[model samples]
Target: METTTATPWLTEEQQRIWRSFLGGTTVLMDRLDRDLRAAHGLSMPEYEILVRLSEAPGRSIRMAELADAVAHSRSRVTHTIARLERENIVVRGQCSEDGRGVSAVLTDHGFSVLEAAAHTHVQGVHDYLIENADAQDFIAMGRIMQNVVEQLHGKNF
Candidate 1:
């Protein structure tokens, strides 16, 4: 027979902090998404995809790799890319090195859109989170997030 230990509940302080973190993240993302959509007609996820592609060589990335970078499923990336393609922001191409692989190429129009939206996104980030936070606290928060990412990603607890 297998035995299992009961999980401990979060302490009061831990619960409070966790809830605050969750609420803050939701608010921050909502604000950023709203700002991006209002100002540049881009969703947060689309902006993220553009950022990733813009940073890639030749402003292109294999679709599977793009999906992984954004932490989205392949189907979601495909759907999003289809939307972007309709807007002339991105185009799909077969990877030269591998005929079976498809790549998302950021169009010139997409780069221009991203350039305009980047300013709003950066300002939103500063206004909502960075500007009000103490430098030491912000750095600590970043480190904490990094640790959480390392702990939760690609492994069982």
Candidate 2:
């Protein structure tokens, strides 16, 4: 014999809000990706990787750290870096300190591309999200998201 506990479920309002959040985020991300692809020939994930590398010291970061910073898997980051490498946008080289670890370095071409893409990305973000939401609401949403991130970071899931 087994004992079972009752499951706790969301209230109607909570369920509705949760669904709205899921749908809204999906649409927002898709639009952003599409906009970036159309304007810069770069996918959102690749653009994110470039942004991370550009911000790092000497515009470079170790492969593993880049994946972690972008919240992507190592293989995924490697694949994207490979594509960038083909386009002369990025290059992978030995880390100077260890000479054993690999790092992704953004090229001059990549920086120029990123500079152009930033305008498109910023405008899209402003048009799609910032302009629509009240300033206070946006700030509150950021706080809520930060709390959510903290909670998730504490758990395995």
**Per-residue lDDT value at 38 in model 1:** 99
Stretches off by above 4 angstroms in model 1 are: 1-4, 154-157
Tens-digit lDDT track for model 2 on 1-157? Answer: 8879779899999999999899999999999999999999998999999999899889999998988787777899889999999999999999888867899999999999999999999999999999989999999999999998777743555
RMSD (Å) per prediction: 1.9, 2.1
Q: What is the lDDT of candidate 2?
A: 0.92
Evaluated with lDDT, which candidate comes out highest?
A: 1
Tens-place lDDT digits, model 1, residues 53-123: 99999999999999888888889999999999999999999889787999999999999999999999999
Report, for every candidate in turn, its global Cα lDDT versus the true structure: 0.95, 0.92
> What C-alpha lDDT, on a 0 to 100 scale, does residue 105 get in candidate 2?
98
